[model samples]
Target: MKTRSKIEEEYWEALERLKSGTTKSVDTKSTRFKFTKDAVGREAGRGKGYVRYERYPLLCEAIADAEEARKKNGPATPTANAKLEQQKALKQKAIGDYNQLKQEYDLLMTEYLNVVRRNFELETGLAETKDVKIIRIPNVR
Candidate 1:
């Protein structure tokens, strides 16, 4: 088993490297940073406010492994088994992350549309305000 302290230390180190700006090797992808206002103040904004790097992929793979383990173990396996339960929990977390990203992407798209619509409205001197509203409804299971 990996030491949690070591894991946490590494996590913080990686975060610090990120915070301090790590060197990007030639192979690394170049991404743009945007400036945006927050409740506190303006801070650097990720294009879509998404973390799309090593940790994201690792989390995704862990979730997949968990799912596979769950399927392989089947209903006969005790659901309370620590490993299986942990895997299930991780899978749920990944799903939640995916859902959250989807929602955020949808919202950004809507915001982009509104901005474009308003730009066109201004250019054409149109008084139509119908297309500026954003409506979000949650699905009930």
Candidate 2:
């Protein structure tokens, strides 16, 4: 068994490598140990050029490991199903919240785009107006 500090140190070194643009790959060892970019980054010191999970094998292994763990531990006992069901319910609730936030974000983005477009149109119209005059108002004490 690896000590907590050792594992953390490995992860941190790997992340530092990544941040320095030296680390190239995300390796899930044949031993089934998976390391994700976010996981690595969370364990890592912060800085730019932090080559994260972006365009990389990030979620694939950790998710697979979680699924495997879930499958392996699933429901041998009669009460296990109940616990599993509760876990599923919680996961579903989290998914629901994520979807709700996504929808709200999409709506907000659309609204913002419309506002920007309107502002752009207004500005263009104002710019094109021949009768518009610019007058500097002097500050009066």
Candidate 3:
């Protein structure tokens, strides 16, 4: 029933001992968790050391605990929730833009048909140019 903090503190202490070369040879993880012989920093040995699961069991456990908590608490942090909200807003805006474009297209198509019908009626002598009616919409933009 140890808390996450307790497990983490012990892990760090053990890691420090291993890195300092003070940990006993009998310890099962002494070799596995030993600090890499390759030096760090620019041109010291090779590349920067990265954390590996086998060498950092406690860290992995802490990460696993966080993931489990996230499952129960919805998202892990406010930043993640904020990102989700941002995605939702973007999707809504796209849908709104699409709907607006669709309405404009419908309006333009209707206007074109009205003009064509009016012109046909006048040319066929079915009605005078003044007698034919074409729709007028104001302030489209």
Candidate 4:
């Protein structure tokens, strides 16, 4: 049986080789094991034909850890930058749309208030004054 540390080390080496394009896709646990075995060579308890099904979970964990590390430490590729720019543009468009809607709301609200005040004056038999301010008190239920 191989030690955990040894297995992890081999996994990392294989991952690095894959990243560097020295190896192809390690898309499956079996392929990952094969890559690790090929890089670190076969051990006594884990011979060439060994299925190593018990180590599948550990290999998956290693792959996840490696992916996270790559995201944190790897260079900002053009694809990543393009995605960021796309998100920024979407956010800016949303902000602009919100501002436009807010302006339209304000305009509509002013027109509605004007109409309500005119109707109030007509109903109350009050003179049409330009400076009359309406104080709306909320009814607490």
Maximum-TM-score candidate: 2
Cα misplacement distance, residue 57 of candidate 1 (Å): 44
Over the stretch 1-141, how does candidate 2's per-residue lDDT look in tens digits? Answer: 533455445555765553344554543322343344454544454333343344233333543465466457544444788989989999999999999999999999999999999988987788788988645589999
Q: Higher TM-score: candidate 1 or 4?
A: 4
**Candidate 2 vs 4: which has more TM-score:** 2
Clashing pairs in 4: none
Backbone clash total for model 3 is 0
- Return the TM-score for each candidate structure: 0.31, 0.37, 0.34, 0.35
RMSD (CA, angstroms), candidate 4: 13.7
Say which prediction, candidate 2 or candidate 3, comes out ahead on TM-score: 2
1-141, model 1: which lDDT tens digit per residue? 543454434433443333344523111122332111110011112223243335354533443454465456445534568778889899999999999999999999999999999987785554455656544589999
Query: Model 1 clash pairs?
Result: none
User: Lowest lDDT 10-mer window, candidate 3?
Assistant: 37-46
Give the runs in model 3 whose Cα sits over 4 Å from its true position. 1-78, 126-141
Reference-based lDDT, each prediction: 0.47, 0.58, 0.53, 0.58
Better of 3 and 4 by lDDT: 4
Candidate 3 TM-score, true structure as reference: 0.34
lDDT of 3: 0.53
